[model samples]
Target chain A: MQDPLGRLAAQIGSGMKLAVPVDYGGVPMALTRAIIAAGIDDLHLVCVPTGGMQVDMMIGAGLVKTIETSAVSLGEAGGAPQFNAAVRAGRVAMMDATCPAIHAGLLAAQKGVPFVPIRGLIETDVLANRLDWCVINNPMADDTGDDPIVLIPAIHPDAAIFHAPMADRFGNVWIGRRRELAAMAYSTKTTLVTVERMFDGDLMADEMTAAGTLPALYVTDVAVAARGAWPLGLWGEYDGDVAEQHRYAQAARTPEGFAAYMASDVRAGAA
Target chain B: MSTPTTAHEILIVSIARLLRGTRHVAVGAASPIPAAGAMLARALAETQDEPKLRLSILGSVAHNFFTNGSAELFDCAAQGRIDAFFLGGGQIDGSGNVNLVGVGDYPEGTVRWPGSFGSAFLYFQIPRVILFREEHTPRVMVEKVDFISAPGVSSEGIWRKGGPHALLTGKGLFGFDATRPGFHLQTLHPGHTLEDVTAATGFRFSHAHATPETPPPDAATLALIRGRIRDELHESYPDFAATLRTAPLPSPLKEPSS
Candidate 1:
């Protein structure tokens, strides 16, 4: 599919759980923009650990109903204005998870396990509040037996979507050292990707890149959206548009400005 | 040795001192000072031939070695590998409870701050979890946090290997006593007195009769911090690094949110 953006948009049914990449780079901004343009609503958006532009913009556009992840901030570029506003306004349901909790949950799903035990969330309100999560005795106990560990339930999203530096026609995408992308792809039912560029030769042909390559077998769809993760970096390929991010941060400060900033997407959807 | 100019530098060096013997020191996102401290510790270790310090600054492509994202950091901590970590909060209580969730109640927050990221997790896993906040007022160091993002101390039954080690702020450095179950004024920072600490701090604590002043960073240490550490911080914290070029302004120490 040469123009797979439309197909990718179609895959995201309303009320479905959609997993995206973490902060800054690796976010599929073009597809995110396309998804926004498509005006899909009631999305259960799962930011990998946290999300910046994509999550904020989506929430601002009233496309998402729930967000499951940790901190949602713009990192150094002023903080997530839109996300903070929505949370304070109680617009979306948020599952405040840590980076590991999200990863461990995804890993458990990938491994087909019911749950995974992690060494955290004992005394915090995060633990107290998460009635769904359980604290169990460490099965493999040392001399100090019955060590309590927090076990997070598996998180299998309906779809995994991200932007990578390169991908081949065969569906293999080179994620470089960002191996978490592989885990995300494996755990989810559908994996949709957009890439900056496509490699002519097979990505798995070389043993060096093979390890980092998420074989197309796992990837359900591919779209060649060059500079797809805009205002966010593509790892080694390109840097984030810092000025644009700063402008976005300023523009997204208020509800009116946020609406104005996202007017183009709304227009695109209507068109 | 020439005395360091700013209180921020003093706090950075003080934090680095706390990380002297640590093998791996990790600083989370939005923490410019702690990031500098970790980098400074690594740089200092290089000069002194100390045990190799693996400094990991979250969100930095150049500084961090994690190919699998911060999950690897958590994995390392779970295995008892990470020696030190830094955490801050919107509200930190007397018992070492940190509240990063928000100001008010849970499930229905009146004032929502950033949701707890890894504070709850790391505070329980990493042995040395230093609570750092530029603001040291009663508003931040509260009588009780509305929401506990990470509890400083847990019940006896819970398998906890880590909790609050110390509380570092703009005004002073307070050491946490698990036995005391509270923070004791260790040393007041330069330009601040015991009265200032007492007036500002919401939590009650004891101090020794002769509590000395917190030492300022010496010229060599300041030079390393300003020169090497400053350069190293650019990749992860460009905004913070840019601020380090000039001597930091003396803090009137405004409340974090207010």
Candidate 2:
């Protein structure tokens, strides 16, 4: 099998839909940086619910053409500077969504359904804006006269990219309760994961760990990159680096500062 | 030894009061005050030996109960499991509409704050949604939002179990009526008058002939807040909890009526 970069180059390309975990920290930071380094452009990035430093860095690198998600910020680290700047500059297209809307869309894809009905969206402008989403009457309502609800279309992305704690040689990844990663992996065509380390034994050997493992069938390729989800947390492993996040939030305020930060912080470590 | 309560402390306690009987309260990411308030309520309930109050703080390892993160939270809310949730916006209107998308028209906007994550879903599904915005100004509370991320009320025939219950600003508190579908001035914060609330508020609201000052947290409440709540809040909101620790003592102007 080819290396991670080779696999990525073969799978990912311009105009493809890429999905990643939200900033609750399961992000594949190193692989995202590599995508930026590769200078991939016009990509449609879907941050499951939201994104953080990874979204901002890729946006700063001019790799993202459009984004579909609910919010992107460092949260408590003073918000997302680069993303705010990009939006202010009107550089990227946006698909504004709420948390459940994204989840419903992914669930629809996972179930191989055309769409799924969700609650609590009909009154919001989100319903008004999304041409792809439709509202249908609930046929099963007891009142039965009319019960309207929103239907979120399935989101079948081109790729599901993320970082995890570890992966066995068989490609089973132990996600340890971040089940959204599994949804993303199952709903996409190609799944590329960067890992903190390789599991010496079969992750699925034990029933307890197997409950958390995403089987190799869904994962197209696994690349081992120690500290892959750096500056972001790796559940059951390490905490997010608050100091680096603070520094990145501060430095990413301006284009010049962001460039310098990328050179000193991102590029140096990425190499 | 006596300790003075800061405005933030008062705010936290006030929010906790709104959450008195809630079984499950979920705090969204980037919300320090709401998160602290939920934890305070949890701590106070524990102190009273009340039935356990489960608080699911988004993105926190220690406090969060959901294994599936946002998905589980959404599912719980939809299933009527979440009792209360919190929401904020760049612009909130008289009718309880919130704008977190941006300031100007859609497709193109002037200012862009973070997009709405689950506010609409939770606002519709959760029975109680406390709208909290620290900056209570015309700019923040607008007459009409440029884009409605999640609406405050829904038309008939739409399934909605929840909507805005109350709106808490730094200066005052207002109760929302989903039926009448407007806000009513409830209680002004100490040191802030009705005129201050009106001047700062972008939308119109009705009020009683004489609005009373919102009661400050009692001594017992303050003790629980400063001691247990502050300590637990550090896990999810370390910096905000730090601010609570270093917060200056309450000024003499608004000293509790002794």
Candidate 3:
């Protein structure tokens, strides 16, 4: 059989806009590595709200051209060096956003709407930078007063990519409570997933799993890449390798250090 | 006699004091101090039989109750379900304006901090937004922020349910008044003088005739902090929790000199 993971990575060509989830949500680190190895470039990366090591590694590898997200940090591991360095060097374009604004934009796309009205960001510099976002008086307000709110336009990415705990042979991925992944898949043109393992039975057949399952209808492809979210934990499956994360953070501080670290046991062993 | 307190313990106690009467308090990522404070507040409430405090520490499996991912947090804030939250910034001014983005020009700033996460929306929706930053330096507590990730006060007629409630730093605490749109120095932490705060702060703030020292946590509170709170905090913040466990016990109490 053809390597579906490699095939899935091939579908994501250079310059495509890709949407990904936050660190706590399932991050497809293995797929990210595959994309990096494939030498994908000029990718417009949209973090669902925020990102962590997955984003840092991509940025360090010089894969991202434009990044749209609220924040990017390694949490306890401290700042994301490559992201900070790239931003400082003006190597990548940044669309600084707030968490809800990103979600609101995705929600608008999911709903197939032009824009969605959201509270806050009326007078913030975050609003000022994004000329795409607009503010208007609440049309629903009657006679009482003029209430103003921000409106975020829909964010339709070329593809959505993430890892999950399980995906059945039918391509139904069980995202459990991480509904933001569903929103991303719904809003994007294509949805590609990597999972730790494949569920034997049909995910939709069971009531408990069905509610949490993203039906094969929305998912375009599924690739079984066991421990796909390695170094970044899945909710119930495993804990993140904090020591490795810290090692990466320290090594990635310098370009040479990053290269050496990537070539060392960590990246090579993962491959 | 009052027990001696560490700087972190003092900040935690201060945060818990501000969290009083709040039903639900949410601590965002990278906020070990605030999370510890919330846990302490919950413990206090349970012991006192006050209304049950709903604490949500983001990134904690055992603590967080949000099932719908990051969106639900904002949605809950929009509906006014979250009562209190903690927001720290790269720069904060007297008017409560917070700048999480870097200094200098937009897009290509000289320095780049992490982008504003949920501050833009949560600052407006959550009722009690505590501005907590450990470093109380002049650069961080600026006269005016280069960029306002979230404004302290919105324009007239704009719908805003929340704004800055208090500003806590390593040195002291400042209470924010939305009406006056300014900050007032509340109390200085132990070992920190008003002069020390004035020297470190860039923004001007008003203060009463005699500023009192922030009260040290009692023996019971200290025990709870070292024991139960540290263990609870370990789930998400292992490094911080470990430090709390190994932290040397404070020296015996000393008389306060006027």
Candidate 4:
């Protein structure tokens, strides 16, 4: 599959139930709409660092299998990056989403360098010991100095999916705003893109101006989906359908509930 | 040493001072404060306290143009152990809890609040979390939040129980009070009064004495932070710098609902 979200949803479905990055308003609507339409397994919502809270309700109600997070959206919520839900909810699967370049950072930690001295672990982790990825004891006295050498293992996933402002048919994407999009891209086996369908964005042409993080080959799919990324991008184009999104996040948490929600007026046509 | 000329400028400068000698920092959504702060600290100003302080910035807020490699935003250097985390709030109580989640409702929010992007985890794990708001008011600094997606000190009394690291607002600075459970008045910004601060805050505050005056941001720090922001952030986010006004003017606060 060339589509970014599709490839990711499909890849994870190969083994574990499908996991998708979701938020309160925009992407979740598109995502839940897709899940319900695709008729996938127990849909789990992966709340990104900056995601809204309704995604949690989806998890609470069982639409989501489990939540994987540390504390971006919440600290913005609670106070610090404190995992309030984790403290209350017994056990939740927490994985480092930014571990795509675990090898490089780990190399920096192990060798006592600023960053991985070399690109030896580009695709794999030679530096991860498992205790905690890696750490830098020397702390690099000379910000530019290369200290010791160690390996940081690869902790990516079967596949990862993201939504960016623009993407080429091949799947390369650009977020315009600086995001861990690259790290996330590197962290996953598959990185997808959802660009603006509007000709005004001139998104395809604008690609020339972006930082150029991913090459076409790096992306395996390029499925065209409208309003792929929501509130995150409404400023750019599409305004999110908040009410519809809330209903889906709440309903999708439960397969039965999501089924009913998917059967609603908005989702029915898509189904 | 010099002082910052504007509120946003001083904020970034002070952030740089705090970041001096630090190894890592995280800047989440709406994080020009931390991103520009660290860049200023790293590139321009060196704290007088530490001879050669080196603070490295990590995360997406820092994901601004300064990051040469997209890979820089990942890793322990960027994500693992962050020193300072910058945050904002639509609703806050005396306890320090923030409310970025919707008010009165969820996705179909009766009152839509910009979602809590990353604060959920950072609220506890991050060593330092600074709450910020350009416009301080009772609406923002409420007595009790209608909805609390994230808990700070939780309640006024709970503040004494050890929650929320710091509260930095447009009007003044407030920190934890080992003795006083709720908010302990730390200092007031120049050109402001206790009334100005209180009018914005719903809960009562404890103060040992009249709060001291907040020092204006020093010049060297401001210049340094501003330079990075103009260069690092403005590159990809041109509208950021263009869209931003040096001060709140008569113009509309946000882009008219597109």
For model 4, residues A105-187, the per-residue Cα lDDT tens digits are 32343344544422111111112212444444334545654443233443344444555455654345555543444444454
lDDT of 3 at B130: 97
For model 4, how does the per-residue alpha-carbon lDDT over B115-154 read when each residue is reduced to its tens digit?
4444443453455666776668888888876655446643
lDDT of 2 by residue, A31-127 (tens): 8777776667998888897888999998888888988988888876866888888877878887878888899899999999999998887867887
Model 3, docking class: medium
Which digits, one per residue and each the tens of the lDDT, describe model 3 over residues A1-271? 5467778889899999999999989998888877877888999999999988889888888889999999999988888999999998899999999999999999999899999999989889999989888999899887678898889999999999999999998889999999999999999879999999999999999999999999999999989888788788998899998898889889999999998887773455345
Q: Give the per-residue lDDT of model 3 (tens digit) for B5-60.
A: 78999998889899988899999998999999999999999888899999888989
Between prediction 2 and prediction 3, the one with superior TM-score is 3
Question: How many clashing residue pairs appear in each of the predictions shown?
Answer: 0, 1, 0, 56
Ranking by lDDT: 3, 2, 1, 4
Query: Which of the predicted structures, 1 or 2, would earn the higher DockQ when compared with the native?
Result: 2
* A41-136 per-residue lDDT for model 1 (tens digits): 999987787778889999998898998977787866866888887887789987888778898898899899999888778767787877779998
**Judged by lDDT against the true structure, how good is candidate 1?**
0.83
lDDT of each: 0.83, 0.85, 0.90, 0.47
Sliding window of 10 residues with minimal summed lDDT for model 1 chain A: A262-271
Better of 1 and 4 by DockQ: 1
Show the lowest summed lDDT stretch of 10 residues, model 1 chain B.
B246-255
On TM-score, the leading prediction is: 3
Q: In model 4, what lDDT does residue B148 have?
A: 56
DockQ of each: 0.53, 0.64, 0.70, 0.08
Highest lDDT model number: 3
